[model samples]
Target: MSFSSLLASSQNHLTPDTNNSLTYTLSELSSLPSTSAQFDVDGAYRLLSTGGFDAGKFEEGIAEMDVGERTAQTQNLETFLEARHSAFINLSLKRSQELSAAMASNLTKASRASSWSAEKKRLQTSLLGSRTYQPPPSSPSHTLVVPSTPGLHASTWSANQSFPPLTPSTSTLSQTTLGATPANKVLWGASRTLDSHAHLHYRHTILNETSTPPDTCPGYLDLLSILETVSPNDLATTSLTWLAEQQRSIFQTFVSQKVTSSSTPITSTDFQEYTTSHNITSWHKVWLALRSSLIPQALTTISTITPPSPVLLTRLKTGSGKIGYGTGDIYRTLIGKLLDFENIQGDSPGISNTEDYIFARLHRLTRGGTVRAKKEDLEGLKEEVLSWGVKYFGNVWSFGLPLFCAGGFEEGISAIKESDEKGNVRAVSLAIVAGRRGLVSREFYEEVVVMYCRSIEGGSPRIAMEYLGEVGRERRKEHVKKLILSTRAYAELAGVVGDDGERVGNEGESTPIDLLFGQGEVRDILRECGDALGREGGGGTDAAELYAMAGEYGRVIEVVNKELAVRVDSFKNGVEDPQRNYWKIAAYNFAEKHLNQGRTHVIERLEREDNLKAGSTFQLLMNLTAFFDKFMEGKFGESWTVLDSLGLLPRTAGEVSNCVDNFFSLDKVARDCMGRVVVAGMECLFNLHASLKQDKSQAAGLTQQGSAGGQSLAQQANIDHDKAMRDIRDRGRLIVTFAGLLHGSLGGEVAKLIARMEAYMM
Candidate 1:
């Protein structure tokens, strides 16, 4: 018979009988089992193929045929059934073992043990052949299964062979029960529940475990270590939410600790290395935390982690993130810290030491040959350095000279105002230093001139002037000239002149112009002025004044003669020079000063010069000077004669008004000189008034004689007295009106002259 037919016969016999008992008793089978010779195993095999084995039918047939007598065949059949049962059990055990091993390799040890228990329960259920048998509940481990293969049937069973059922131990039952239960029950179970809700407790337990534990619920250090191993993306995927929570908590704790213990030394080497190795995108969080805890240390750490200049510049070009966070944020933060002079308190090493360190680091990071930092960053850095240097180093030039030089001249000059006198001097010195190095622009020198000239009116003009002199010594002549001219122009524009016709408050001190350019250069400048004005056909009176101030009589005379010749030439050409009157006044001042020394040549030359217009204001000034010189020399008569010739002896109100109007028509500078001329003319009028009064008194005394000849003399005296009284009244009114005009045209000095002339008239 074929194995399929035999297996089919065996299957058919496996069914339970109708009476619920064996149809044939073992006694019947025993009747034939005594002798192997009587057993027909081969014939039984043939019969096994013809009809399926019904235990009742087969037993009855065996009894009728005395088949029970063949004990050897029965024994052989029992051996076959036992062998088949053992083979089936072995196959099931092997499959279960394979599944368990596969699961053990793939899952955690706890899961693998649970899977083994589930597999054992499944094997027991299959072996028992009981309808009440139940499979274990599916779990993480139970989800695993053995891959099915052909011809491997789990239900294949033998009736004659029996295996013992599995009875689980108490501990194993509890474990299986726990695995079978719902997740909520398992978590809440008293025996299986966690000891504490704190993460630290759980973390400690995880750290203490010998097996490879999960990194899901790790501590701070554990997370840091994991960061070293995993990529930023993987790390984020694994513990992003947990890391964010931990980051906030840890940062808060760090800040609290730092705030409580301000002297604690904070370091970021580990954090930096971890973030850098993982290329963490949320590094700004870490940096911000560290900075909040300890800014200087955090900045120092970040500065080290900054990429090379090229890479940093490229990243910066990519633009900052929404919150202005980027790879270059560290550099910017460091720069801000370094520049925050007002807030940064120094260590025991002092602010300078800290500044040096910061500056060195900045230079090292930003130095990209010619390019350095980004344009905006470079400009911001320059401004910060200038501000910081000026605040801490006494001046920007002292510590940030290169940066200041790189800036605009207006910026440099504006920086000067932020400093004291000493600081300004130092700044200018540094500017000169830069100039010597050929790093300064033309605007720098120009700005310097402007600054120093501005200071001339300020309270620190002396120091400013001294510094300007030093600068002028090193600078070009044109620059010095600009300085001098700017000082002069500013003084003029600001109306810095006092009542004395000199710069206000500088009488006792050297003028800024004189101090900046020494007297020798001043004389040269005066000569240049003379030449320049002469070329322009304007008088060199300003030059003559400067020369006279230097006590250079020769140069003063030279300038006056050149100026007089120019005026005379202008008159001959009918150019109608307005400044001719001013030049003549300047000449008059010079001549009067030297007149007592018998140096009256200029006065004589001015008077004899006819091209200087016979009735012009120039001739009036010369005549006035001659009149004053004679009056001071006790030549009152000649003074009177000179004054009369110049139409100063006004006989009526019309003449007096005309004279006063003409005097005021001159330039203000010429008006100042003409004030003295008016005073001299008033003196001549006063003397005439006094002489008339004396003659009138004497004529009254003579009229009292009453003799014929005496009467005739008295009559002539009376007529002469009447004429003198009219002249005196007219002259006194002229002097007083002229004095009033002088007071109105000129300032207090002329008013004083008016008072003195009024005293003589009275």
Candidate 2:
């Protein structure tokens, strides 16, 4: 017979007979009998099918069971879909008959049970959903039999087979209810029982009549689409229904694990709240590329009480899930709902019940600054919050008051330490709390002080500065500076911190830096600021002073040199502008300030720098200053000793190379004025040479006037003239070598000055 006809005939071919018998196929009959062959028509038909029929491994499974136990079974939908598509083949050529007509009937009945139930499930879905939904049966089942060839009558078939009694359960279950047994959970086409995990008959994947979303991970759902299509009226009913199903499944799983009732119950609240990157935030367009969208609408819809009602929002906001930081008006709404605020007194008084403390503390925390209240009233209110905290030390809800109170500071610190030891990640909260009561102490408070400071540094430092006065005066100074520096409040740190440690700027945000840091501490802070600013393209004259005050004379000189280099073009043109001398004057003022502090601190600063050549920075500063003074005074020769060392006046071939090397070796900020330094050095040499030649001519005139008396003076003066003239020749060589070395580097303006220096040599 054909496979489909065999399957159909197998469905009801057996009869109930007391005497059991086994029928083997021609192949099996020819071999030695192995364990008296039992009958399973369902298994035989599946093994004979052409298509992937019953590919669920059902044939392999039912074929193994004894006739007495293999009567009928059913399946649950999720499990049926899980196994239905699996490719299973049985190559064994053995064919057998059904044990009884009941077993034969129930097997097909099991497959039929889930086919229709799954139909009800797919009815609402439109797009993609769980891949586990039962696929349409690829091979149709039938009830009629057809033979492939001319067949013999019943006599031949009867000789080959015998019927057996049906299983006891086969008699118990009718056709439709056949799959209601406890085993239905394990196989296809079975229904869920009371013992199953889900209490809900099905998880609804539909939002409305026209809209059915995929059964997706909770976060992936298009929540706004759900809200918009939810008819506005149904939001009341469906808003949190998903959560109920989720919580029920959790409870069932907890029970199934055999956890005792006395153990901590696993509720939905116990899990960390679900948040997603795809979340739509509140009404504000926080950014152009990213912003809050439907969150405000969802919050308002769920929280409003006018028409649709706020039964859901009230539960979430008033209960543990306060999605506000996301709070202020949120807490006010919730707290107002919880209390008769009109009855609570806010005067200079104390508390009697928990309601009094709750209202007073929450009000102070959320609205104290905005509301109109007397000074004594606010102070007395905060004091009461602290008093109430002592009364209920373990009441974590009112920690607001105890955090600012020094009375129980030691206990609070201990609790924070214990939390850290337990590996609990309460970082942001612990930091804000530590920052508020900014005290550090030894003895009872000593052990916790470091942990508190560390926690403060680790978490939201922005939350701590409000009550900064509570910190010990001595510790506050250092801690405040660290907070400023770490936050990169460089501009604020640059503001003059006086000897008394008060900041000079009027910016209220930087009041901590001003109030807590003294000049001594600020010197170090400024040094770091100067370096950071210098790297980010020179911090200008202000940055130079920062370096100067920090005793980093090299950077001080480097910055001022760069600053004065900016004015080199104007200086070369001999432009008579006061502004041209700005950085030059700045360098002088810094030097005088150093002198006023005792000695010019350049020598001391240079001594500390191990990498430096001891006098290089000091010489740069001295030459830069003296060059500024004497060049302005038309007395370049007076400053020539220091000026030559500034890498400006190279007098030999080797000196030119050294000058170029030093120019490249300096940082970009320090390189800014190098070309100007060269131009200025050339001009100074021409002027110094002229000054020496003029002195030589005056000595000649003196020698001619007083032959005997001025003879020795003129001889000594001519000796000096010969030496100075030789130096001028080397200076001329340097000018030519530099013009070649600098090629195109010194732009059009400095190129003209170098050309003039070469022409002067001619």
lDDT of 2 by residue, 161-237 (tens): 22111111111112233223221221111112221211111212211212443222121111111221121222211
Q: Considering only N, C-alpha and C atoms within 3 Å, which residue pairs clash in candidate 2?
A: 75-187, 75-188, 75-189, 75-190, 76-190, 324-327, 438-471, 503-514
| Candidate 1 displacement at residue 659 in angstroms | 14
Supply every candidate's count of residue pairs whose N, Cα or C atoms clash at under 3 angstroms: 9, 8
- Evaluated at residue 727, the lDDT of candidate 2 is 80
**Root-mean-square deviation of every model:** 39.7, 30.7
Error of 1 at 65 (Å): 99
Q: On residues 29-83, what C-alpha lDDT tens digit does candidate 1 reach at each position?
A: 3324254123333223322322212333333444454223333223322232233
Best by TM-score: 2
**Where is model 1 more than 4 Å wrong at Cα?**
1-422, 438-466, 469-544, 547-589, 592-619, 622-711, 714-762
Q: Which stretches of candidate 2 lie over 4 Å from their true place?
A: 1-511, 514-538, 541-615, 645-648, 653-659, 666-670, 688-727, 742-752
- Give the Cα error of residue 644 in candidate 2, in Å: 2.9
Residue 642's lDDT within candidate 1 is: 79
